[model samples]
Target chain A: MKQDPDKSRMNFPNRALKWLVILMVVFLVIEIPLLISHARHAYFKIDGWFAFYAILGFLACPALTFLARGLGVLVRRDESTFGNEDDKTLPEDLDEQLR
Target chain B: MNNFADFPPALILLLGALLVPFLKPSWRSVYVILLPLATLFYVLQLKTGTGSQFNLFTFTEEPLEFLRVDKLSKAFGIIFSLNAVAAFIYAFYYKKSTQHVAALFYIGGAIGTVFAGDLLTMYVFWESMAVSSTFVILARNTEQAKGAAFRYIMIHLVGGLLLLAGVILTIARQDGSIAFNGFDFETANHAGTWLILIGILVNCGAPPLSSWLPDSYPAASVTGGLILSAYTTKTAVYTLLRGYPGWEPLIWIGCAMAVYGVIYALMESDIRRILAYAIINQVGFMVCAAGVGTHDAISGATAAAFCHILYKSLLWMTTGVVLYRLGKSNLCDLGGLHRTMPVTTVFFIIGCLSMALPGTCGFTSKNIIIHAIEHEHLFWPWLLLEISAVGIFLAVAIRLPYFLFFGKDKGLTPQDAPSAMLGGMALLGFFCLFFGFAPGTLYDLLPHEIDYHPYSIAKVTIVLQWILATGITFIFLKKWLTPKPGISLDFDWFYRKGAVQFYRAADTTLNGANALAKRTFIDGFVKWTCNFFESGASRSTAWLMTPIWMLQGHNAEEIDSLQQSIFKRSKRGAFQIGITAFCAVILLGLLSIIFLLE
Candidate 1:
C-alpha cells in the first residue's frame, strides 16, 4: 500500500521532530565525553561535575518555563490591560475637550 | 583650523543633525550614513591622552577637560560610530527626516559622553543623550509611543538628576576637582558615590527601576528602538566604569538584573519586547564586570560593551525588517517564516551571536567576563550568571527563532528584507562574524593589556554545553516554553498604575488641605471679622448706654427700650449723635493711650 501525499505532508512535523531529537542525541553523545575531560582544568569545581551544563540546561528550561508560567498567571494580562490606563491622559469626550 | 585635530568627533554628528532636513531625501540619507563614517575616522584619529580644554568663564578653578581619549573612550567611540553608520543604513529607505535628525543627535550625545574628560562635561552630554533619545521614541507618534517616551524621559531625568547631585557633592568635598575617576576608599563610602552609583544603575536598567527600558523601548519606531538600544545603557556602563569601579553592590544588582531580564523575556510574547528585555540581560554582565573592577575585568567589560552594541544592533535590525515587512511582530502571530524570509532568518541566526553560542561574538566577549569571575572565585555570583546564561540562551536562541521563524506555519508569506535593509544588516552581520572569528582584533582594542585568550578548548566547550542543553530542553518541553499572547507586569506597574496612585495620593493630600483651609480661614474667621466691622457700632453703643441708664435711675424696661431704639437706628446707618459721639471718643481715647504707652 502506498501512503497518501497530503497525509505524509501532515506527518512532516513528526518526522522532523524525530530527526531533530536524533541529531541532538548525537551531539550529546559527543559533548558528554568532551565536557568531562575539559572539566579537569576548569576553574569552577562545578564544571568537574558530570555533564554540568547539559544537566543545568536540561533542568533549567522546564523550571524557568513553568516558573514563567506561574509568573504569567500572576502578572499576565490582556493586551488591553494597559490600554485604558494609557488612555487616561485622553479625555473621555475628546472632541469636547479639544474644543 | 591649525588645531582641527582637537575637535571632538561628536560635533560632526551634532552639526550634521541640524543640516539633515535641509537636504533632499536622497542626500539626507547619504548624509546621515556619511556623518557616522566621518565620526569613525575622527574617533580613530584621537590619540590616548587628554586633548583640548573648554573653560566656562572661570566656572572651575582650572579649565575643564572636554576631550579625553583614553583607551576606554576610544574603544566606545569606535564601536558607537560604527553602529551609528549601520543603524542609519538600516533606516535609509524611510522618508521621515525627523527620525534621522533625532538619531544623529542621539548618537552624537552618546559619543560625546564617551569622550568627556570631566564629570560636568560627561553629565552635560549624558543628559543630552536622554533628551534626544526621547525624540527618537516620539518619532513613532503613536499614543503608546508618546506614553513610553514620557515615562522614559521622566526616569532618565531622575537618573540625570542623581548623577548631577553626585557630581556636585563629590566636587564640593574634593575642593572643586571635577575629574571623572573611580570612587574608592573613603570616597566609596561617601553618600556622593552612592548617589552616582545609583544614578548609573538606573540607566543600566537595574531591577525595580528597570522596567522603564522594557516599558518604553518596545513602543518606539523600529529603527528608533535600534538606536535607543545601542547608546544609552552602554554609555551608562562607561560612566559606571569611570566613576564607581569595584563598587560591590553592583555585583548583586547586576546578577539580579541578569536573571530578572531572562525571566521577563521568557514571559514576553512581543518580539521587540523580548529583545528589549534581553538588553537588560546583556548589560547585566557588563555591570557585573564593572563591579569586579579588576584591570582584566574592565577590559572584559569594554570588550563586552563593544560586541554587545554590534551584535545587539544586528538582532534589532533583523527583527525590525520582519516587522517592516509583515506588520506583525508578536510571537503567536508569526511562525514558519524561514521558508519565505530566508535571508532575514539567516541574518537573525547570525544576530543570535548575542546568545554567546560557540563561534559567535557573544562567546568571545562573554568568555572574558566569566573567566574573570572564576579567576576571582566569586561562586554565588558566578553560579547566578551561568543560570542566567542558560535562561537567556533558551529565551532568545531557542524560543524566539523557533516561534517567530520556524514553528507551525501561520500561512503568511512575506518577501525577504529589502536590499537596503539587507545591506544594513549585512554591515552589522559582518562585524559579528569579524569579531567572532578574529577576536584578537577586538582584544587589541581593550583598555588593559590582559594576558587572556578567549578560544581555549575548555572555554569553547562550556558555552557549547549551554547551547546543547538549551536546545534539547527546548525541543522536548516546547509546549511549556511557547510564548502566549499576553504581556506580563514588571516594576513599571508601580509607575504605571502606581504613578496614577501616586497622583491620587498627592491630589487627596494637597487638595484636602486646601479645602480645609478655605473652610476655616475664609468662611469662619474671615466672615466673623467682616460681620464685626459692619455691626460692631450698634452693639458697642447699646452696651455703653447700659451703665449710663443705671446711673440715671431709669427703670430696666425703659432703659432696654432706649438701647433697642439706638441699635435699630445704627443698623439703618443712622446712629444717634450722642451714642456715636461716645463710641468715637472711646476709640480715640484707646488709641491715644496706646500711643502714650509706646
Candidate 2:
C-alpha cells in the first residue's frame, strides 16, 4: 500500500524524541566543564551571574517541556483543511466508519 | 613589518560588492568570481605587525574597524577567502544572479569579519553574512529551501542580536574602546558572554539549538549545499578562537556535537544531511581542540579547520553531484550507478577516505587532534572521540557510499553528472589526496610550530589498525547499524518539534486569552471589589454570585439584578468617594486632635 504523504512526513514525533536525547547530552556536557572551570577559577572573585546562568541552563529542561507542549498544538493543524471526502483515499482493508 | 597605517585596501574593493544586485546576470557571475579574487589579493598585501589596524567605515555611532590582520585572523582570513574562491568556481555555472550576489556579499562579510579589529565590526560583518547567506539558501527555489533558509536566517539573526548585545555591553563597560581582550568570565558581566556564545553556537550547530544544519543543507541544490556547509560553522569556530579560546566547557560541548552528529548521520537517509552531520562532527574535533587551548592543540585545531573546509566541501560536492544527476538523494532510492559514473565513483570514494579513512586528509588532521588529547591525557573527550570514530566509520565510510551506489539497485539510471560538476568534484578530491600525501601546506598554514608528526610509523599503524577494526566491525554488524528505512533524530528536533509544539501551545493559550480577555478582566475586578467590601456585605452576597446561585436564579435579569443590588449596597465603591471626604475631615480635626492628645 502506498503510504500517505502526510503520515510519512509526520515523522515529526520521531525527530522530537531524537532532539530530546541530543539536547539532554548537550545540556549535561556543557555544564560539567563549566562547573569544574568555575571551581578552578575560585581565586578570581566569581560574579554571581555564572551561578545564575548555571541555574538557567539546568532549568531549560522544564522550560523546554512547557515550550514543546505549546508548539505541538501549532504544528498539528486541523486535518479537515485538505478535503471533506475521506472515503476516496481510504484503504481496502479499512472499515468505512474508521475513515 | 609594514606601517600599520599603510595596510591594503582589498576589503574596500570587495565591500563594493553591495553593487552586484545592480549588475546583469552574466556580469553577476564574473563579479562574484572576480570579487573574491580581488579580496584575496588585497588580503595578501596586508602589512604584518602588532597594533596594525584599519578604520574602514563608521557605524551609526561607532567606527567600523578592519585590518587587524593578526596571526590568528590571518590564517582564518586566508582560509575563508580560499573557501570563497573554490565555492565560486564550483558555483560558476549556476545561473542565479541572487546566488552570485549573495555569495559575493557572504564572502565579503567573512573577510570583513576576520580582519575586523573590534567587536562591533565583527558584528556588523557577522550580520551581513547572515542576511546574504540566507538569500543563498532561498535561491534554491524549493519549498524546503524556503523553509530551511528561513529557519537558518532566524537562528543567525537571533545570534546576531546576542552578539550585538555582548559587544555593546563589553564596550560600555570598558569605556568604549573596542580593543579585544579575554574576559574574566567570573567578574566580567557575563550577560554578553552567554549571548555571544549562544550566537556563535547557533552557527556552530551546538546541541539543543543545532537542527538548522541537517534540516536545511540537504534541501539545497547541489552546489548550494556545498557553499552552505563551508561558511557558518567555520565562522563560529573562528569566533570562539578569537573570543573565548580556552573555555573548558566548549571541549565537552565539541565532543558531544562530534559524537551526537555521527549518531544522527547514521540514521539519516539524505546524502547531504549525512554530510551535514559530518560537518558538525569535524567541527566538534576542532572545537574540542580549541577548548584544550594549548599552542599545539590550537595548531591542530587550525589544521583541522583548514583541512575540514577542504575535505568536507569535497564530500558535499560529491554528494551534490550524485543528487544533481539522480534527481533524488534518498539512500534507499539509490544504488548501482558506479557502473555508469566511474569518475564520480572515484571522486566519492576519495571523499569518503578523506572523511578519516586511512591514508586520506582526514587521517592526518584527525590524528593530530587525537594526539593532542593523548598529550593532555584528557580521558573522557578522548574516549568519546574514539567511540565516535566507529560511528563515523559506520555512517560515512561504510553506510554512505554502500547504500547509495552498491546496495540493491533502486533501478536509477541517471546519466553521469555534467562534466562541470565532475570537474569541481575532481578538483576538490585532488586537493584532498594531494594534501593527504603532503601535509606540508596545511602544516605551514598553522599558527604554531608542528612538533607532533602525523605521519610517523607508530601513529600510521595505530590509525590504520583502528580503521581496519572499524571496517571489520561494520561488515559483521552492518545489519544492526545500517537500517535502510528510517531517519534518526538529532538536536534539530528541538527546532523542528519543540518549536512547533511550543508555538502550537502558545497559539492555543493566546487564542484562549484572546477569547476570554474581557471576561477575565471584568471578573477579576469584580472578585477583587467583592473581597474589598467583605466587611460591609454579608457572605451571602458572595455565595449568591457563585455559579450555583446563578443557575438557581433561572433568569438572566434575576442574576443581573442580584449582582447590581449587591454592587449598590456594597460600601467598596463608596470607600474611594468617602476617602477624600475623610481626608478633609482629618485636616479639619487634626488641629483639635493634636490639642486634645496634648
lDDT of 2 by residue, B1-598 (tens): 2335644333543566668678777777666766666666766665455334444444323444566766677777776776676766666566566666676677677767777767877787889888988887777676667777888888777878888887877777767667654555456636777677778888888887777888777766667778888888887888777777677888999998887777667656668777888888878888888788777777787777877888788777777666666556777678877877777777888878886755677777777887787777787887677666656765787778887777677676666666656666776777788778888877776777778766654455444544554554455455644434444544555776678789999999998898687577667877777776664363465465668756676477776676665666564545356866888899889988999999
Model 2 C-alpha lDDT versus the unseen true structure: 0.68
The model with the greatest DockQ is: 1
lDDT of 2 by residue, A23-80 (tens): 5564455445545545322212321243322233233223322332344334323323
User: Residue B450: error of model 1 in Å?
Assistant: 3.0
Over B1-598, each residue of candidate 1 has an lDDT whose tens digit, in order, gives 1233487889999998999889999888888999999999988977898577777746676556668889999999999999998988888777678888988998999999988888888888989998999999888777888889999999999988998998888887778888887778454578777787778889999988899998888778778888999999999999878876787888888898898899899999999999999999989998998899888889898998999898888989988877777667799999999999999999999988455876777888887888888888899888888888889888987789999999899998888887878999999899888888888898889899888876766667767776877787787779887878878888988888788888999999999999999999999999999889877877887898789999999999999899888777867877568967998999999999999999
The prediction achieving the highest lDDT against the true structure is 1
Worst lDDT run of 10 residues, candidate 1 chain B, spans B1-10
**Model 1: CAPRI class:** acceptable
Candidate 2: segments with Cα more than 4 A from true spot: A1-99, B1-31, B45-47, B50-64, B181-189, B357-359, B507-510, B516-598
lDDT of 2 at B215: 72
* Cα lDDT, all candidates: 0.84, 0.68
> In order, how many clashes per candidate?
0, 11
Q: TM-score (0 to 1) of chain B, per candidate?
A: 0.87, 0.81
